[model samples]
Target: MAVIRQLDSLAPDFDAQLELLLAWESVADHRVEETVAEILREVRAHGDVAVISYTNQFDRRQLQAAGDFMVSASELQAARERVAPEARRALEAAAERVRAYHDHQKQESWQYREADGTVLGQQITPMERVGIYVPGGKASYPSSVLMNAIPAKVAGVEEVVMVVPAPDNQISDLVLAAAAIAGVDRVFTIGGAQAVAALAYGTEAVPRVDKIVGPGNIFVASAKRAVFGQVAIDMIAGPSEILVICDGETDPDWIAMDLLSQAEHDEQAQSILVSPDQEFLDAVERALEKLLAELPRREIAAVSLKERGALVAVDSIESAIAISNRIAPEHLELSVANPEKYLPLIRNAGAIFLGRHTAEALGDYCAGPNHVLPTSGTARFSSPLGVYDFQKRSSIIYCSPEGAKTLGRVAGILARGEGLEAHARSAEYRVRNK
Candidate 1:
């Protein structure tokens, strides 16, 4: 029973419709902040002992020892062998595509000299170590491994340590295969808040890293959010979401199935559609009912669509674009004729799917763009995780005597305006000595 709110009839209540469809608000409650805080402190104090206790309690699995927790080379090789040849080929193809796309995002350290011989530039360097967390609960996303680790590897990070949960002391073969493809240096069997804490503070086995990245559950997100100052984090990701904008003429079945595709992700996931025609809206509703019946995750999809999804009929496509900008969805699909016409109008969206043929799922798997997009309406400010996340920048400036003398006056004036004598003296000293 997904809510169908007709925009024509409820023109004055568009705000309410927008609010109902915004699942991020509910998911952004930060409910586990205090819980994560306690776990982080305990893990920080007790180290590996705390991690083992929490894993056994929450994961309902026992680890004989810390040495047994680390994935051995033989174990990884066996997991790789277990992967079917076709799946391996597909993983390799995906790795190739991901590597190719991120290779272009690699940045170079640059410098330029002025007439006075002031050489000012930026020096790009890779982080010494980085940690990537991969979830292993109800679903396994091998693609996430490639998305998180490949960028760090390309950036020349010294070490890329990975942590994946073992709910029942089991890690999927696909995940291990993905780790191999992405060039992870170490793989640890840990997850949830403890995994994040271990990466941030460094357990006996897991090494502390300069930064941590990847997707995870609520406890994991809360732990990352809690340990922000100690180590860098990519972004505070919320639940997955997708929004599709269509004209009245598009196929209702296509629209309905597209919405459900993202809805099946989880109960907290949201799917939204905006169109101007009432007839098409009705058709999509019927299509959802017909199509949802066949899905294996029908119950989850039903709960998600009924509670968090929406269909809004705006007065026009222009109105739809305006509303979408305000919402700032993670994945935006334009199911309209000549969608490029509206491209310039989109000021906010993590990833833009061009037309009816370009569904969000394509972007999730094989598309060139990283699927690790900003969630919880963060597209307004944040960007997708990329090669830049793994690299650090340093200011490079070599001012010759003439260059220092030429630049000192301006620097001294600005320093004086700010009432900082030390800053002014430093610049004055350079010029006077020169």
Candidate 2:
């Protein structure tokens, strides 16, 4: 039977056990780094031809030219019409919800004037173009297309370029339709480190983007890391995570399934449950064993739970929340009677699901929040993807004649105190004989 690691706060070495369970270190694989470096170099040197060659070799495709895989407007339209009515409706609905939620996150430029008419504020500007990568190796992620692209569009990004791997020259229609709905300006059938390189440095076919945002395998992550200074990138996400704090009232079945949701993502993903009731933890474990047999991806989830998942018995609900904050989980679920009572105590999390009915999976799909989130323990400092990621802020300062005279004197004194006469004179010149 599949079993998740169990812990009790009353144990002598509980803290140590928890520490061991939560420990996640990503050591760089030298081979992966070298491979990505070579791909980047080739893409930079050969441009479109390089991208074409890499795609053919990696994705098992036979392509003649760079334009062979460029998705045209007609193809996008065809995809929109080709999808089943039910699937198309869900895509449209999810896209609309994502767009609506991000619309509220849009920032505007603002300024304020002082008595002397010295104005100061900020200007919000969208990036000219952005690239969003969608992983198409194991499964199709139309939702990813919406989550990454809509925010940029809502932030007023002019052009959105998307790249997805089409292994065997087959891509998903739903993904294409999603691109249409999310306002993606361009779509290309390419992925992996080469796709990242193409986006980072302009190729003959792929235009260089100001920023690249999305998730992918290790090759993509390493590529993004290698090209950090060349272009901005979203966070390097780790394995998916979910921490559930229950009061022992929720159905054991539900809690088990919630934990499995993260587990099914991969072997590294973690699903944790914390509650004061030891019997509840037992019940969840049994439920997990039962559910594991029924899942299509049972083997994957089984390994993930056996190795990475956990069930902890806390002293009380308060203690459970304390442990949660310390973990800084990516997804936190308060599956208790009154979930709001603990909101003030939650200082760290990428997203919070309140009450028993709010499944973390809902947030992953149509919950209207960006599913792209800080992973591992990054929730302690980072945040969920939003419109802000696609936008840039610039400080605005305008000094009036009188304001300059008053400020220049202070600036001149400060500059000279630092022993830079050139800087001091520049400031003093502004307020000279005022």
Candidate 3:
């Protein structure tokens, strides 16, 4: 049987156990930080030379110049052609759905005039350029390309520069094909801290971007942290997580498989089930044991289950929800009969899987919602990546002569109270003599 822990909400030590289970420190180690810092400094100083050197060393590629790292337009088209017909169709379909979904998230400029003839509103505009990092080699993710690039395009971003490490000069054609479909403006075969540095501080070969988004290994994560002020970045994602709040009505096999889906991501990934049914929990436990032997990633999944996974028995569905809110998991599955009824009670979650039929895997792919989400309980404040992330908003305030005069007295009083003589005088100058 799997070594998953079983707990009851009524237990005296339940709170402490839950806290221990939820705790995870995503901080990069000192060695990684030191390495990344050195790379960032080198890249910032040497530009293309530093990038070329690091790419050659890390990716085991023989490159004479930085220009050779760029993937040509013909290469991208060839990748698209190389993909199987069925896979191409699936990619196109998924891209269309993702594009359509993010279209709703696009913000537009809006203004309104007050009675004093003052115009106040907001203006929305897209970032000129963005860099997206796609993990390469055996861990290639085509879905990530569509998820990151499509939203930027939908938001009217002019350039989407993508960087992926081609280890041993072997790149996944699926990833390249997806990039082509998503309308990426440029592609570079570079990875790690060097690629991030190239994007943050532009080299002659790689242009600097307004924002950098996507996932990478520890070195890349540290680089993103190191260069935060230089360019905007997406959230520092932690391990994948899934919290299933079942009502004991769903099939044990289905719930067990759902938990495994997240656990298979990695040993650090978490999968938990909260319900009021003890019998149902036992059934799921049995199902887990039976299914664990079948999965290809069973070793990793088993380790995750033993370390972080849990089967918690609560007093009621309401109690389960309260616990879930405290956990604030990355992916939440309301596997109960009336999932919608409980949605309002969910205060924090990166994404909410609505029904028993709606699997978390769907959201990762063709479900239309951007799967780039807040992880490690960050859903409490952060949100999923969307078109808004690619757009910037500027507050618009045009004060008419009459409006300035009307508001100057209030501003002058506030400025004087703050002990700023210059500010008071500036506002006083705008005030008309009565």
Candidate 4:
């Protein structure tokens, strides 16, 4: 039932559909902004009182003080006991895989010495503190906690604080267990724009952090956007999306199932398949029909597929890659023969899955790379969440008299070219005095 369009059917008007694909990118009404802004101001003004009140009103958890917000070690242990043995083992496996992948992302400080006695270096240091927002409701994501916190741990961040919404003052044992596994320093039962505000502007219970990282809903996104100056935040993530590039050789059933995997995330999700062969196109359409009836989330995935999904018949695999680059999808699958051959052509996409056996779902759970990625076309400029996100880099420079004389002359010349007299003098002072 998804929109099936032949290349010939795409008139200039069809470009409009491509644009509509960005509907989730629409910023909510200023009313939401004004409302969130007011909530932030309240948290800023009243500290813990406003946070507690809003938590009660929104999350329905009446907290008398900041201490009530924290999840204790006992609760975490209980969560481990409550979780199924299989689930716990699976989570442990996922954590191990994630840590192994991010270990490769850890940065090291390096210095380079010049012949003129100048030493230039870069020092990579972790943030002293960071806050992670994990969604509540149907959005309980223990996988996300592992994705966000393990990197901070790997980066040697001193403190990792987590804020999650819990409607009944009951936080998931599973999420708490994941936090424990990732070595989170604290867990707060608070969420929404108010939780973000609490993280940005320290409450009596929540300490202001240097950065915030994790996935959230629209309100959480807007709050992060609002608090950017006060605290660092990961990218304002767009909606979930997946693009599968298949050849006639791959099974249409696999293609259909893979496409639905992302579409089931939400009604606003996007799924698209690109292929050069029409026979494969027809087969995929038939497979989608057969599979769509069997899926438990058929209604949601069906609407998402029909509204935002696509089956594009490109002229060749090269054209498919060109089209995919333009889309800059969050997940790109090369479900073709020898996917490695085209890896060089893919300059965009948040993550790439090489070969038909490597499904995007592998990346979501047990695969090593983080699932938290830039969505929409932001992948064209951004990247997946990594240890680098948890750390900051500073330039290290040391110059002796000889080095100063050699470097300052060029610095003075550049400063003078920009008409920055003060800057020129600052550089020239070293050379002149030396």
* TM-score of each candidate structure, all chains considered together: 0.95, 0.98, 0.98, 0.95
Better of 2 and 4 by lDDT: 2
Report the lDDT tens digits of candidate 2 across residue range 1-434: 44888888889999898889988866367999999999999999999899999999999999899889799988998999999999999999999999999999999999999999899999999999999999986598999999999999999999999999999988999999999988899999999999999999989899999999999999999999999999999989889999999999999999999999999999899999999999999999999999988999999998899889999999999999989999999999999998997899999899999999999999988989999999878899999999999999999989998988888889888999999999888877879867
TM-score of 3: 0.98
Query: Superposing all C-alpha atoms, what RMSD in Å does each candidate have to the true structure?
Result: 1.8, 1.0, 1.2, 1.9
Error of 3 at 220 (Å): 1.0
- The 0-to-1 C-alpha lDDT of every candidate, in the order given, reads 0.86, 0.93, 0.93, 0.87
Candidate 4, 2-29: lDDT as tens digits: 4333342234665576666546645565
- Worst 10-residue lDDT window, candidate 2: 21-30
Q: Name the Cα RMSD for model 2.
A: 1.0
Cα error, residue 174 of model 1, in Å, equals 0.9
For model 4, state the Cα shift of residue 186 in Å: 0.4
The order of the candidates by TM-score, greatest first, is 2, 3, 1, 4
Clashes of each: 0, 0, 0, 0
Steric clash pairs (candidate 4): none
**10 residues in a row with least lDDT, candidate 1:** 1-10
Runs of candidate 1 exceeding 4 Å displacement: 1-10, 23-31
